[model samples]
Target: MNVFYEEDGGFKVGAVLADNTTSLQVEAPHGKRSKIKAGTVLLKFEKPALSEFMEQAQHVADELDADFLWECSNQDEFGFADLGLEYFGHAPSTVEAAGLLIKLHGSPMHFYKKGKGHYKAAPEESLKAALASVERKRLQALQQAEYTAQLTGFSCPEALLPQINMLLYRPDKNTIEYKALEQACHDTGLTPPKLLEKCGAIPSSHDYHFNAFLFEHFPKGIEFGEIGEFDIPQDLPESNVSAFSIDDATTTEIDDAFSLIHLPNGNWQVGIHIAAPALGFGPGSRLDEIALERLSTVYMPGNKITMLPDALVNAYTLEATKSCPALSMYLEIESADYSVVSSVTRIERVKIAANLRHDTLEPLFNEDTLARGGPDYPFKKELGILWELANRLEIGRGKQGSNIGTDYSFVVKDDRIAITDRKRGNPIDKVVSELMIYVNSRWAKMLSEKGVAGVFRSQFNGKVRLSTTPGKHIGLGVDQYAWASSPLRRSMDLLNQRQLIALVRGEPAPYASNSEVLLGAVSDFELASEAYNSFQRNMERYWCLRYVLQEGINEASATVLKENLIRLDTLPLVTRVPSMPELPPGTQVQVALSNVELLDLAFGCEFKHRIELQ
Candidate 1:
């Protein structure tokens, strides 16, 4: 082997004949470009050392004297023993053969003089084992990644997200219908809270149940109410409103009713009919006790568990079909100001006609169809008088700023919730409500004037104190007042009815001195019942979220009427909607959704991701 000539400095410097393969021209990067030079200190053939095979073989080639031919087959291992051919400028055939042999051996090798060298493992076997170990580690890591992805219920139900979007429904007001909620306990191996937490990530029935549980368990305070059942027709006049089947034995208990009449003085008279339930339920009866315990009805779409039983609310003591037991109070309304001008109390039997619900009656008064519909339609001649009277009362009430807030209604169909905001006041319903308010207000005033103890119906005024309005009939735009109606459904009404009985009989009123204490209890019960209903509504929403909003695009607008939360108008058409924050007020955004879990109910088919701004 001969030293190569070089023109680029270092090593053998000088050109060699063209036939000398050890010398050659090469180009190298000098700042931004490359320059060519001859005799670039090229090498002939040189063997890579043991250390070089383990790390940088190219570095060893650079320091060699011969032209180092870097040849590698498909196999990764090469050995020094592969350098068997003598180099004489060009040796393609022999060099290629040696390279093939090294690849076949499949191992790195180190060679030393037999008598003076050290001992080492066979390069092929050692290197093969090392590579296999590396591969095994890589495979284990990949398997772990897959396993981690599949685990779903530790903190989130990623695994269940795909199934929740299609199984939920809303059956009634503020209620969710997930037929699978009970079954989830078995397979999920979790308590209600745990299940809710995991399913919160997707759509699941547990979402609603658990969210309600959370709020109920941690309420700021608690309130309680006593239950009562009253006759609707006996205490009020009939509006001739053929709404629901008032004669049906299954549901036609007279709890409330109303009538409007024209007085000789050219003023209108509004009458409210009420059944006295407190007369029978008493204070310690089984139904009374249960009513006290339950405090309110738990109304779901398919099922309803009343706070009182049919024995008390429907059958016994109910003023139905011209039958009445004992009456408490009669309220008279003066058309001049739509005011309760006079009220009288006595024990009297009242007549009954028909019972009605808003749903059945709304159709007859529908904005679309009227008297032209058919024969069975109840919107007849005399009924028009009642409607006219109701309209007058409502108009007068509105001008006075009565707190008759706008309301929304829903009809559940096809396991979905259909919402409607077009429920303008039903004449019959309004007449009934207004007449009852008049009667109750009269009774409340009578009790206050008589210095007797009785229950009062009250609502907190939207003021800084959040306290029940101090004697203001704000909802009716009247002076300080309270309500005492539907004794069977409300303990306060029962107490008032009982007090009215004593007062009418000229008997001394009960607790005339400490009436304030009794008033406190009544207020507490009313407030507690209201809180309970509010809680139930929130719980139902949680269920809807899990079942409808977890996996779809949700387009909605919301308003914050109260300080607590914003109400979104998204349920009727969209299911599995995304959260509202991403699509802030007045600004809309496209989203990809998977599931929604708010307050406990799971909803939606998929989670949503924002796609574009609108």
Candidate 2:
């Protein structure tokens, strides 16, 4: 006898070789024998061969209407033979019974299986809902196929227009749009960004990179919301000195400046004035909250997101011709040796005499000019005296003979970029850096002595860290260094400025000793600043590549750092050239640029020849 049975949820036919009471040894249609349980067998027939049974049954099942069969069945459960008998109006044949069983098994929405060879009709409501869902999924599959086809042909479906950014940056894999995009990307052998660009979805490379940063960091967008009005006290004490600031020409938020007063007691009193925006806004204030969210000014090649609003920066910035409130550090020193006799901190309004620009000042006042004693300029005497003190301070820090490299400044206007160079440890830089270092170190000392908590910068073994407690900063060769300057640009500096102001006034400090708030701020700022700095460096590198292509210069000089990685001399771009020969560090070589991909910000170069070892 031939037997029809269910195995692993599918119908199969076999020839029964030896029948036992509970089981049978059977050979399948393809001649493979297996021992199967008698309960699993649905039918036994004598006329049809085992191979032809399933084919004929499937043909009959294909001809029968599953819905009609479901409607014809009893309301309760019934066997397939009973249903088949009622449908055919006689004792059904094996093919009819098997076909009906297969039809009922396949249409799960019309009929639900109760047991082997038996099923119950689905309720009208459940059947209708299931049918509708099946139809919906069928339509979605068709639509997804069409979208994928369109994308493969370099056409973007309109449905993807509004979701392109999300699809590119943050994708939801469950959605059909993302699935179609993923499939299309696989077909085209390109990344999502590149494929979309090919389909003309993203046209601008600049916008692609810029939007990537915004999507990750500034998801809601970089806009300042409504801010409450603030009051700056008009009764701040006025000072006698006219302080002048030295900064770049693009600087609007002048943070620090200098003034000199020749004392009648034969000593020189030098004033280090820092713009005091902290006095106008305290912690938990509107401006303070704004600064905290941003943490610091995010600087790219030519653009920046200022921590404070422009109006606030203008009110606090020490611009020339305006006497702005300042946190002044007065150092009374001997005129002969520039030794600090006394140092004091005070808050007052000081007249801003001038704002010096690097482009103009570096030409007239520099190392060569100072060594020659040949020429003079505005604030020349004060700059000379400050440079002397800076030398003393650098030597005191035990960092003498340090030759830091150049700092590149980028200016982007329209599609054009101008890169300029400034030596890192020049006399002008030394003056400003040394004086700021002095103030920060001194304020850190005062805060530690007064048992007040502040954010301290400490570095050891080339790893820099921030902490609430005072610690030695081996890099600066100081007891402790707390940033108390640039209140308009950096939030931590602003926070420290508030603490310093409170200490100067003999009032309660904003941050208490061992304050969790201070420590948390330090940690949060460190993370945010690292991300911001990375973005800045990436953008700078992007602009450097742009400059190279815009200028149309193919040959460039590069200095070897280790083996294959080198830094280009023309711009601050460091990349690897696989063709580079093994050379010592500081060896100069010429390289030719070939492919410059703006979208990926990748450069392809070939090492041409070596210049010299320097």
Candidate 3:
């Protein structure tokens, strides 16, 4: 006897070896033997042969109309053979019964299985909804294929234009657009950004990186909307010294300046003046809230996002010829040794003598000029004395003031980049850095002594961190350091300035020691500041690549830092050459650059030859 049975959710035909009444031992057409339950057998037939039975039944099953079968059936559950008999107008033959069973089993949308060999016609509404869903999926599959084809052909689909940033930065993998992009990326063996760039989806690589950062950090926008008027302090006492600021030409937030007075007793009274934005607004105010949210000014290659509004920065910036409100730290130093005899902190307005720029000032006030000592410039006498005092301060800190490396500055104008390198630890750097360090350390000490709370920057065991508790900064060689110098650029500095002002006036500090608010601000500032700095570094790298392309640089010199890592000599670019041979660190070599991918901010390089040192 031949039997058609449901096994493992599929239909099969087998010839019976033995019938035990409850179970049958059968051999399949291919000679494989198996035992199946009697209840699973849908039909028994002795046809032309077992081998030909399945193919014939499948053909018949394919020829049957599933909709006609469903329409002929009643809503109640019934056996397939009974439905076949009803449709055929007589008892069904074995072949017809088997074909009907196969058709019913396959057409699940038309009929739902109730038990072995039993089924019920699906409800009209449910069946229609299921068919519609299947059709929709089929259409979506076709659309996805079309999108994939377009992307593979270096063309972006119109549907994916609005979602380009999300697809590149943070993709929702479940969406069909993302799926198509993923498929295209895999097919081309390229990253999403590179593939998109090839498709002309990314118009500007610079804007690509910039927009990605803004999308993450400043999602709403970079606009400072409708800031209310805030009072600028005008009642402060004016100091008896003419102060001057030294900064970059592009700088608009002039936070710190310097002054000098020759005392009649052969002592020099030096003044370190910091712009006092804290006096215009207090903690928990609207401006303070805005500053706290931004945390710090975000700097990139050619631009910056200021933490404070332009109006507030202009009102408090130490501009030339303006007596701006300041937090001044006066040091009475003995002229013979350049050592501080007494130091005092006061709030006053200091007359601005000038705003000196580095490009113009460095040529005249550098190491060689100081040695010759004849070229006269504005505030040259004060700067010369301050430079001497800075050297003495460096010696007092037990620092040798050796040059560390080169510092690169990027200037971008009209989409062109100019990268210039300045030697670290130069005379101008030492003077500004030492004086800022002195003021920060002294202010931290004063806050600690007066039992006031403030934010401090500390380094120990090669790790640097911010905290409310005062601690030594081993990196700066300071006893205790707080960033109280740039109130217009940093939120933490503004907070510390508020505390310092309160201490100077004998008023209550804005934040209490060990307060959750203070601790939370420290943690948030650390995270935001690090994020800002990382973005800055990435932008700098982007500009470095742009500079390479702009200057038509193909071959360049680099100093090897590790096995394959090297730092470019002309620009602040560090990259790896996979083809490079094993060389010691600090070995100079020439490398050939190729395949610069801006969207990914990377390049390919080949090792050329080693550069011998002179």
Best model number under lDDT = 3
Task: Tell me the whole-model lDDT of each prediction, alpha carbons only.
Answer: 0.44, 0.89, 0.91
Order by lDDT, highest first: 3, 2, 1
On TM-score, the stronger of 1 and 2 is 2
Candidate 2 collision pairs: none
**TM per candidate:** 0.51, 0.94, 0.92
Candidate 2, residue 239: Cα displacement in angstroms equals 2.0
Give one digit per residue, the lDDT tens place, for model 3 in 1-614. 99989999999989999999999999999999999999888788887599998888888899999999989999999988789889889897877788888899999999999998899999999999989998998998899999999999999999999999899888999888999999999999988988998999999999899999998999888999976668787789989999999998889999999999989998999999999999998877889888988989999988999999999999999999999999999999989989889999999999998999988998988888999985898888988999999998888877766546788888889999988998888778888989998999999999988889989899999999999988988888888999999999998899999999999898888899987767988999989988999999999999998888888889999999999999988888899899999999999999998877787789888999999988
User: Which of 1 and 3 is the better model by TM-score?
Assistant: 3
Model 2 error, position 254 (Å) = 2.3
Deviation of model 3 at 358, angstroms: 1.4
Give candidate 1's whole-model lDDT: 0.44
Q: How far is candidate 2 from the true structure (C-alpha RMSD, Å)?
A: 2.2
Best-fitting candidate, scored by TM-score = 2
Q: Please tell me which model should have the higher lDDT, number 1 or number 3.
A: 3
- Candidate 3 local lDDT, residue 374: 58
Give the Å error, residue 41, model 2: 2.6
Q: List the residue pairs that clash in candidate 3.
A: none
